[model samples]
Target: MNAPTSPHILAAAQRPIPDAFMAALTARFGSQCVTSLAVREQHGRDEGSLTAPPPAAVVYAESTQDVQDAVALCHQHEVPVIAYGAGSSLEGHLLAVQGGISIDVNRMNQVLSIDTEDLTITVQPGITRKQLNEAIKDTGFFFPIDPGADASIGGMASTRASGTNAVRYGTMRENVLALEVVTASGQVIRTGNRAKKSAAGYDLTRLMVGSEGTLGIFTEISLRIYPLPEAVSAAICSFSTIEAAVRTVIETIQLGIPIARVELIDVNAVRMVNAYSKLDLREEPMLLMEFHGSPTGVKEQAEMVQDLASEHGGNAFEWAERPEDRTRLFTARHNAYFAAVASVPACRCITTDTCVPISRLADALLQCVTEADASGIPYFLVGHVGDGNFHFGYLIDPDNDTQRAQAEQLNHQLVQRAIALGGTCTGEHGIGVHKQGFLLEEAGEGAVAMMRAIKQALDPKNILNPGKIFQIG
Candidate 1:
């Protein structure tokens, strides 16, 4: 099957940015408003293959009021407003598809409040996961939702991002407790609250968690934090084949091992990582795992997983107990995407995120692997396999149309198979411009219509991140 094209792929019309809007933006934000081509260029694109023109202006929002003012100006002028955080999104999330302005929130980085007694922390949207952990390092707690990149908390919330820890800790959808959002018209509204559970009203927090900036801009976020695990141990086990590694993950999850973090890195990705990260690791299909709990509990869990690996023809486990050692191993795993991209100079990656049920993971992954190998497209594979989510980074030279089409076709096939196997086209990366067609394929017409209705109600003008997720009106 040919790759599906997003309806607006080549047809997104740029809306006019009136001089009056610029005047208002300049008057309100002053130096914070930047119209330089360089700055606008930086804000206009994310770490994705899709490209679009830069926004007309970029506003550095230092406070919630600043975001409100900028968004209000855009709303009044009928201009689109795309929220900008760390700009680490893998999909085309930051593209100014229809042209307007970008609200950069990196200046808003701050920890607003931390309630250790309640196991919660309220933070400005700009704070990155690593920074949050550093601020609360002395408090015996850490935020668990890590999407690898030092993505801003707001970006993570917008994408409902989950990472290596998701198998045990859950995604942003579960951990985010409350939000202070600026509506499409610049009205500030709070969704949910610090309370753990509430039955009072619609779950607006849930609605906005993965809205991908289409509904509103997140100004503040409160997240559930977890106490540091009593014992943390990490290990890597190589396997003879990709199926063996994936099968081990499926069986481990089925056996209910409570594995904290289990990741799969195929041979090509491992080779790239070794070159990029300058670490000597087993260049084979490998499972990198971590165990968390009390000392005895961690030991028992590790022993059980080790036995399972051996049963599946996995090599002897290589353990990392020193904190620094464990950090080194995971840091490489997190950098796998970049490594793969850099391996081929001047090549852009079309990454795929497909998640299937644990029982179907082997079938889904093995089939995709076979197809990718047959297609001869250079690719790297890595996954948070414990939760049945994986990524394939297809590296293709930008000038080669045939290579790009091949990568997209591979991505399409994987997403369709994932959907058929009771999975999502996207596990963590939100549906940005690149995945709009996949969203339609997976959600069907009726469900997408409801989503469009919600977007219409929340953003009547379609001024908030217009032309993303789906075409509005």
Candidate 2:
């Protein structure tokens, strides 16, 4: 393996900014408000391999009033305002496309209220999923929108993120009860309440859940919580082929198994995990499984899934019940992307996620793998298969034109296949410039026009995270 090269370092350094912008920002916000260049650059991009121009300035906001004032100032100056969180998004969602003020929300991390009776928690948007969960640990309840990253609740809500547990707990769309947002006009408004359901006027809460921060900046969030199960068990099951593993997942879901986490890892990913994590495991297609319920319920559920796996020629099921063991298992799975990148130094990681119907998952995955092999691109496969969503991480040398072309070809073919099979180009990761064209292809021109109209109606000034989900005309 070769040493990693900073491909976009020079370009990022050369990115220009307005001379008076920093002075104005400092005048408005004290010296402590602005972060150093290292911090600004760190908050500018996400885990995705795409390079983006860093923001002209980053503001450390501490409260909703601060966010509102900052946004109002940007709106007045005709500058873009990008909300910054933990920078864990996978589609370059945090990139300062228009390069203006980045409202860093990490300072606002605080759990304001936890209503045990209502099973809801009100927290500042910058609070991460892990932090929230730890805070609520002793309450016998937990938030379930786990996006594999310790991502901020605000970022997760913006992206409408879901993860391995989505099959059972749903995504941020269902888990977020309400949101306190600063609109494009810089007015602060509450979207919803603690009520379980409502027939409100416009359902603005749901609309903003997946808006990718293009419409408003979330200051605080009210999230639905679930009672921590009486028992939790995780397992790993191997299969002879990727087809068999996917087929088993489809069958299990069709059977309505209450699986908490059912992820699919192709043989290639298993190989990478072995090399990166130093675990001597079978180099075959595998499924990382989990169940959350009462002891009896989890036992019965595991039995049912085991029988289904057996029908698909799956190998012996190895279960992990201890918390440490469970953590080790998921830690490896969560680090799968980093492991794949580690396989080839000096390579940029380009990952694409697509969701298909459960029945067509095997066919879709087979086509993706076939195209990847034919193009001779080094890639690894892993996904939340229970929900029919998967990701392909392609390792490419960006300087090599042939490698770049091959990766693009594979990405195009994979997305086309997904759309043709009545699936979406992206399931969790929002269309943050990387998939704008594919989104247009997936949702026809009329749909795109309607989306643009909504954007205009909500954000007439176009100051909130401009040039994100859609191209402004």
Report each candidate's C-alpha RMSD, comma-separated, in the order given.
1.2, 3.8
- Residue range 5-99, candidate 1, lDDT tens digits: 43223447899999998998899888999999999999998888888889999999999999998888988999999999999997889999899
> What shift in Å separates residue 339 of candidate 1 from its native position after superposition?
0.8
| Weakest ten-residue segment in model 2 by summed lDDT | 1-10
Using all chains and alpha carbons, the TM-scores for the candidates as numbered come to 0.98, 0.95
- Which candidate has the highest lDDT of all? 1
List candidate 2 segments past 4 Å from native: 1-21
Q: For candidate 2, what is the lDDT?
A: 0.86
Candidate 2 per-residue lDDT over residues 342-384, each given as its tens digit: 9998888888889999888988999788888777788999999
Per-candidate count of clashing residue pairs (backbone under 3 Å):
0, 0
Candidate 1: clashing pairs of residues: none
* Number of residue pairs clashing in candidate 2, backbone atoms closer than 3 angstroms, sequence gap of 3 or more or interchain: 0
